[model samples]
Target chain A: MALPTYAGPLERTWYYAFRTICGLIFFFLIAPLVVIVPLSFNAVPFFTFTQEMLTLDPAGYSLKWYQDFFGNLNWHGAVKNSFIIAVFATLISTTLGTIGALGLSRAEMPMKTTVMAILISPMIVPLIISAAGMYFFYSKIGLAATHIGVIIAHAALGIPFVVITVTATLVGFDQSLIRAAYNLGASPTYTFFKIIVPLILPGVISGGLFAFITSFDEVVVVLFVGSYEQRTIPWQMFSGIREQISPTILAVATLLIAVSIMLLASLELIRRRGERLRGITPS
Target chain B: MAAATTSDGALTTADGIPLKASLARAERRNRNRALLLVTPLFAFILVFFLMPIFDMLTRSVDNTVVGSVLVRSVPVLSQWDDSSGELPSEAVFKAMVLDIQDGRETRTIGKVGTRMNYEKSGMTSLFRKSGRRAKQIKEAPYKEALIKLDKKWGDINTWRLLKRESDAQTLTHYLASIDMRFNDSGEVVRQPEEKQIYINLFIRTLKLSALITVLCLVLGYPISYLLATLPVRTSNLLMILVLLPFWTSLLVRTTAWIALLQKQGVINDFLVGVGLIGDDGRLAMIHNAIGTVVAMVHILLPFMVLPLYSVMKTIPPSYVRAARSMGATPWTAFWRVYVPNTVSGIGAGGILVFIIAIGYYITPALVGGVSGTLISNFIAQHISVTLNWGLAAALGSVLLALVLALYILYDKIVGIDNMKMG
Candidate 1:
């Protein structure tokens, strides 16, 4: 807000002080993430900045850590497993969650609150508890130490995001559009694909992205239920941090930060598009 | 088809059905369609998520280990009174010898010993030593033979332990989880001072989580207010500073903290370079409680800010202005008017952060070396390292109960539908 002309010196001083406090808080939120990028490129295999790097010598930075991450077979396997599990988990969670959100948004749905609570309980429960429970139960059913088991666990973890996001999108949806399509002689399936899907596509994509990230970043459950064969990137990073502190983890962290930036950008774009389509101006 | 007219002169459909019945049928069909769409995911969650949790809950009190291993002795021992100071009769010792022999043959005696060891410290070796000797006693007067083989066999408390643990269900694990145990007389008592860890751990977890939640709110409120009161274009650009970390991987942020907080890391180096501290006086920030609080406050700050911003955005700015125009001081207007209105956001964010921080595992494990580890770390240690599934499950159940209680409170206050992710 613009300062009023009648504002006193105290108000002016407090306003600037408030702004400065917020600026420092924002720096606290983002500085750690930004600091790792340049350190990831350090020529020495250390987490701290070197004298040469601080002096801006080109010799102080190198791509050796990136090379190590790419060339290592274990890292390769972890990357592959992460994508495969995340893709499958996202697909399952999105399909189920979208359909469930549709039902949840319906006026005629029974026991809506209880059903919603049950569907999203996966998100509410702590991950360690989930991991411990899955470890015990999956072992009994011969699902432990298998890729399929980790996939299913991750999918369950991802579903709540999909349901929440999709349900939110459906809140702004116009139901009359569906009736209009039906009255115009469109079949039920045709109405769904042509009218409903188009309107909620942004929500669905954003939800899918959420599900993907949840699965991709998940490590606790995989550690409990999966063997080395099912290790993911976070799992690798966890071990790397624990067993040996390496600059390669920094390189990987930088890449992951870049990925998150891209995802955040796309989610913003989709949000704007969804609002525009719904005829709601951005506030 | 014959038209059926209701006594109250209700309308009829063209198909000769009552109009209300037709409407009810349509409604029922819609309900079924909705339920049908939801059934698959519901069942999936039931099988995969809910069932496993229930299974773990059962493990907390599932005391079939001692009973199943000592099947013969349990039935025989049930006939004896444990309150009697005297040891069991020769027949009881006979049955014990047979049970231990069978258990040893099946290699299940160790499980029983491990379970019993949780109750009493020396039971594992006692069971092991007795198992090796029980097979050799092929004669009568088994009581003397067992006592000669191991003096622990003659102790009245040994028989009491057998009788108590023989039941198919026991609260021993639950009791042990809270740092209490059944003493020689079978009354629940607090564990010995040195052995009492879990209770302190539970308290520490709560205290640390509360501290983290308050820290997050303090750091988050000013930024959230600034973002909300700013023009939309500026706020949107500034929002990325919050959302970027929100969307970033938890491990990455934790790793970043490790890089920044470690003794030899960036923060310490900066301090040393600036001569704020001597080179030899670098702070032990990482691997301690300070590290956990700092890193977690950063990680959970966005959760606090996002909800606050959304709530603050809805509050009209004129309320504070109205208060100011009524001769209220600026601080009075802001605190008395604005802060009171944001209480719901505070509740939502406070409970959310506390709930999350209480159950945090990863960041704490990486940065919180010994003194800073929460209950979740102990639970993990039991599951993987100690192989104490029963204790792990009990600890987990306690944590789950806490989280669920807070969750119900959150659902009551904020409504779960309002829980928004980036």
Candidate 2:
């Protein structure tokens, strides 16, 4: 990355300019996220920083927006629904995804490419199309507006993440180990729980995390498939932004960011552990 | 068919089981287990995901509502040809009167009017007024009486529109979605100027997506280059900045943009304090196309950076160093030797970002004010408020088709199996 010793003044200027541009671009990536945390604590019901905030006065900040978020029943209901739906969706998607990936990982599996494409189509297809489709179909089956419907729809969307991550993990699995377990007189089920599960636990956990986050963050399908009783946090935030611009949403956004940070950190740790398990090292 | 057999003249496995029957059963059992494992989720997705979309697309052309609502009159009206531009006979008008009365009695006649309004404006009030008046008249000269009630009933064009939209399935909704519709004489034609919004919105969406792709490349190239060229320790530390937003909640990121870019927002406040702009001159940044672009670029930047960074990291730096050592100037070596190598990354990043940006709804709906709503918003509008699911379905199909085509191209360029997450 160092410049040549014989560089002219023009070259030196351009080099510094290029680095400055990159610095600004990096700042652009992080500044919005950083700016909102402080703004969410504003004492006034405004998005901008007040003069006192700039002067570092303690009076300029308050937790009233967070208080508002907690006190409001609509927000409370949405948060509750978000967790309930996400948990069940994660459960279904992870269970189905693990088994599906196991089948897909088999070298003997027929039409592997076609099946992979079919399983992952939910991810590739646009959410609007998927939402529109589910909206009509769920209503037809009398599942529209039900908690189970939204969960099922979200699970469908989450399945691909599980399949992709779990399949990636399964790629490094040694099939000979399974054969050895069976040859040693262990039951097929026992071999799976004892041998396969231990090796793929990290992938399964990470895949479950992906499924959970996907369900939690989803809004489009919920908008179509969910009724008033099934409103999720993202759904509420969507109507909030649409109907009213308020600081309560900013507060919730900050809290959601905290949750994401936790999820991302866990994923990073899982990736490292998975790599170690697979005997992979950075080049 | 012949099977491999042991010297004992019996089909058998190496372990001495019958090879022909045993091998076939084992293979069948293996396939059954695989199919069993996939069946639950596959059935779930087939029922919940694919079925609804297929049903929705089918809804785009489903004209059953209008046909059924005006069943008695539609067949009668269809007999009147456009050759003479003549109003239908009194029997036709009487049938229309009976159908309108029956529709109002059943409380389903409003649907027919709504369907016709989607085809021709002002048909809503026309149906409403006639339905109310149709209940009052019992005269034999029903055509004149109906015309006297409202002159629009006498117009052949209204009857033509009614007959055109009376089919059990029609392409009217699909045509309307693309800013085209059938004229009164049954010819395809452009919609009126005021209603010609969707075609422009589609064009604008493509243009903005392209612009965002360009913006992503411009801003992301330098950042990816820095990350790729810097020491591993520094690059790894810097990589977190890119991944944080990548994993962050989309609504949170959009809200962050709103907080930063709205009128009286942080950026405006800061600029006002710094005397860069007057207090009244606060930039309208958040509720316009610019807001959509700025926030979308921020949200989608990581997508561009990850692919570009991955590709750049794989390219050996020695190639450029060798080019320079061989008397290629730094500029020449960088462009001719270095830039071409990142083409794969650019293609991957560009296509991924463009496809996502085209289908984006939340950010655009929130920050993109009236003038900024993309085609996806319009589809959502028809789905929800307008209650025109047919048009919504048609628009959705177009979008779905467009995305699938682009995805196929992307798969061709960069194998889907090679897609990775950081």
Interface RMSD, per-candidate values to 1 decimal = 0.8, 1.6
What TM-score is obtained by chain A of candidate 2?
Answer: 0.95
Per-residue CA lDDT of model 2 for A1-283, tens digit only, reads: 7787988899899999999999899899999889989999999989889988899899999999999999999999999999999999999999999998898887667888878877888988878888888988888889999999999999999998888888888887899999899989999899999999999988899889988999999999999999879999999999988887789988999999899889888988888887787788842
Q: Write the per-residue lDDT of candidate 2 for residues B334-373, one digit (tens) a residue.
A: 9999999999999999999999999988899999997677
Q: What's the fnat for candidate 1, on a 0 to 1 scale?
A: 0.84
What value does the lDDT take at residue A211 in candidate 2?
89
Residue ranges of candidate 1 with Cα displaced over 4 Å: B1-9
Worst 10 residues of 2 chain A by lDDT: A274-283
For residue B102, model 2's alpha carbon misses the true position, in angstroms, by 1.3
State the weakest 10-residue window (summed lDDT) of model 1 chain B: B1-10
TM-score of 1: 0.98
Encode model 1's per-residue lDDT on A80-190: one tens digit a residue.
Answer: 999999999999999999998999999999999999999989998999999999999999999999989999999999999999999999998899999899889999999
DockQ of 1: 0.85
TM-score for all predictions?
0.98, 0.95
- Runs of candidate 2 with Cα error greater than 4 angstroms are A2-15, A281-283, B1-5, B8-12, B15-25, B76-84, B139-141
- Model 1: per-residue lDDT, tens digit, B338-368? 9999999999999999999999999999999
